[model samples]
Target chain A: MGNRSKDLLQVEHSHPSSSRESSLLVGKNDSKPLQQKSYLQGNPITVPFPKSEVLGKVKDFIGVISEANRNLRLYAKDKPEEYDIEVLTGNESEYIKMDLMLGIADLHTPESLAAAEAAIAGCQSVINRNSTSSSLEFEGSSEEEEDEEEDDGGEDDDTRQSGSHVRHKDSELQQDDFLSALLRSHQKKKPSKIIELSVQSGSDCSIRSMAMATLRREGKRLSPLISPRPIEALRSALVPYQEEAHGLRYISTQAVRNRMKSVKSIQKITKAMKMVAASKLRQVQSKAENSRGIWQPFTALLGDIPSVDVKKTVLVTISSDKGLCGGINSTSVKISRAIHKLNSGPDKEAKYVILGEKAKVQLVRDSKKHIELSITELQKNPLNYTQVSVLADDILKNVQFDALRIVFNKFNSVVSFVPTMATILSPEIVEREAEAGGKLGALDSYEIEGGETKSEILQNLAEFQFSCVLFNAVLENACSEQGARMSAMDSSSRNAGEMLDRLTLTYNRTRQASITTELIEIISGASALEG
Target chain B: MSSSAAVPFWRAAGMTYITYSNICASLVRNCLKEPYKSEAIAREKVHYSISKWSDGKSEKPTIRSDVAED
Candidate 1:
């Protein structure tokens, strides 16, 4: 290939351009002979752009320019004058240049860049949250240790049970067991959960706020349960325990209080996350609803597509780029793994289309060979049907796939997001979807005109399928993300609040003990004087 | 391009000139007039005349509280 042709090809392959045809048209001017001395006078082979920085800053602008120029030369080979050189300035330009070099070097997937961006965004968003939600403390216990302790207690309670008076006794025992289990679990989980809650609250105040609201509700629920415990025995045991351990209880209580403050902060963050997710989910749901209207009629026109002899399959896996929301990415990853396991043969290799950066990373790590095409920045403009169509077209034309499968987290509601898989290319899937039935009332109302050809209908159907798959996947993934984030924040806030409560109690008790000891010394002194 | 960038500044200056008198008048009234006004001038003179050498209220309280507690 000519220098210009090579540059054009590189640009088409590497950069996120609006279109490739425009570059191709420009690349035809490659006959502008390499007569002019090179862009830089230095030998082409000498000192390939400096990677090191002097005093934490690039010492050579020439090196940076040369590196950019080299790639641009390759990219601009076909279309030398087409690229806007101004766009190659500042931080954005530097990063773009770096990415181009990385892409050429073939170090990582395109999703890796997106993942790094999402992570930075996530970190910034968290920091912003911490600053705002400073006041509210929703304290709770941690999940891991609490889970084990509760599981054991639940097992013990379940084994002993039935008969009126015995039932009453059993009920009493169970409630006590439950409370004791909760308290014990809280003691174990409180420290770590408190810290996590505080840090998250600091990072994301909205979640902390939500957690506070949950804690208030929990506190109200806990109030009724508090009285049934044998207070006298517990108090006596606690008091001696407090004294015997060289003020360890006092310190523990202080730790708990501080943790509680952290939890309250965290609750605010979680609550905010939930609200944000809820709004985003609603938007996604509407998009999905609209997409259904578009796709159902399109599919209906096709009548039926035979699913027999499914040879090669293309699977589009959708997940969120950033993970604070629990199990959203994991669930999608699981579904992908399941699909990989099901479609494992040399002839029937599964071509993977990863929608989100996080899912792409996971799938790439798991099945290195299967990821044919990966896309990121779905979260930036999730409802862009044009992008989806482009992606779908690339899959449909470039590769031979007998069928298409889409896996994503489905948004049932604010709290319930389930991992769902749909076979898009198969008639069986459509038939099942039609038979199993869904919320397609809006779609049924749209009327089509007479004598529309099958080809047009198929074209429309293909477009609709792409749009629907993209829309539904985005909605489900987003819903799952928000829900998971809310819960995580909620737990953190609760954990913090619990720590504060324990701390305040200890502080009070310490004060009381000091007062009592002082009184005793005064009384003893008085008695000796009297003697 | 240079001429185009400077055009807005000249327009802004003309607008600022039109509002200058009113702005100056408001500044004098708002900033200077208030301080000269007197409130209970006789009481202020009495406090100035009979100023006793005593600790500030905050300082007195701290002293009293500490002594009482002791």
Candidate 2:
């Protein structure tokens, strides 16, 4: 390729007529050329010529030529030989004029258009969004150029094509710098037309592309001398497709990064909740250690029974105040609903004494009429004998019933809990049972002490037993809540981790793909410029 | 009708056994250690903020220990 360029330069130096012949030979001579980088390492490699600086230099040169032509046009009409010189110089002027048009066309051609758009891409997101369409136009134009003045294929192309087209008219230097009017009249007509079109289409993109396409098509048609060498055409066609793939890659990298960030934050939250729940479970389980036997007195006096035939029954539900414990509140609510259904009838009446906001909200929706006394926030503070005693006294004063059942969740392990109910009988019911000689009637066999009346002693014991049973129930329910919450948060954190893994994989693959596309663009571009 | 031990002071003062047991439970709950003690004391400490709506807007609530004393 280097030798061929040297051969073309020699032809340009010899005579204007043989330059066409040499360009044809270079086009046809692509047989079995030596393919080595060593062949191209020499002085024949000229500076890449289609740069904006080079274009400016060429324009400055044209300005001088046009000035000289204007002066010579006054004297050339009288002499025939000088007229021929004028015509031939006119032809050289056309070559330079074509150079000026390609310079302008170089700025407007699809590749340069894409570069300009890319320069503004940071500010104009609207423009970047339409990159695919603009890329289609780039390939359609097949204007082989890399990033402005930096990469070589198009600059090298402009240099080689302009070198062949602008052969010095008379190599003998006789008609060379003559103030002859070479194509001065013809160049004026076309550029004036182009300048008019450029002005009209400056601000609007659609009009600008239309004008540029027209200029390129007409410049090739009108001045057949300004033609691109045929070999450059085959290589220029593939540049835009390579760029198209890169454009697609650049679009979605940001979206993938955003998804990765959100998933990571969610994982952080769930992990913190899991840790909090574990610590809470430990504390509550320790407090619940001595709460088991407080219900023994009520059991001994009442015996194991569900109070199936009681006329008036009160079901006391112990649930946690706060939520996010999985299935703890719901399981208790379901059991309470079943017991409520069993205890409802025309002659029999049942009431709910709900403890805790979670179960109260559920029960309110189902049986708002049956709820007698609902107390909440019992678990917000630590449970103790005094609080339970006060609360049990309040319940006893607020509602009148024959049988009272305290329902709560009993914690067995970290992963298991049982819905349990401890039943307590009213004093009147206890006294009747003693008269009827049931298992609880054995209480009469012992000597009771320290009360003005026997019935008052029974009431004292009942109230004390109620407070103890309530304290135990509240502690057990708290332990269960903490255990359920620990497991729930643990699973949430695990699911977040899984989602993050999938997103990170996608993020890595996309980043790698974008990098490879850029490398392919640079290497393919370098080879195309070589061609 | 029964052999019995001597009555406690609250019962001798004509208070019911229910009131006596509650007083004992309260005293025991107040003697707990650290975190449990603080919460239990706070639970038993009741303060009423009494407010009166005269003509239009209600007056600022005033802390009243008299209600719990009664």
Instruction: Note the DockQ of each predicted structure.
Output: 0.00, 0.13
Report the poorest 10 consecutive residues by lDDT, candidate 2 chain A: A172-181
In model 2, the runs with Cα more than 4 Å from the true position are A1-247, A450-452, B1-19, B26-70
TM-score (C-alpha) between model 2 and the true structure: 0.53
Tens-digit lDDT string for candidate 1 (B1-70)? 5533543454366422112323343455445443442221211110000011122111111110111222
Q: Model 1's CAPRI class? A: incorrect
Model 2 lDDT tens row, A53-81: 33334335444433444444455556756
User: In candidate 1, residue A373 scores what lDDT?
Assistant: 62
Off by over 4 Å in 1: A1-261, A302-309, A390-399, A426-460, A522-531, B1-70
On DockQ, the candidate that comes out on top is 2
Least accurate stretch of 10 residues (summed lDDT) in model 1 chain A? A98-107
TM-score of each: 0.39, 0.53
Model 2 chain B lowest lDDT segment of ten? B46-55
| CAPRI-style grade of the A/B interface in model 2 | incorrect
Chain A TM-score, each candidate:
0.44, 0.54
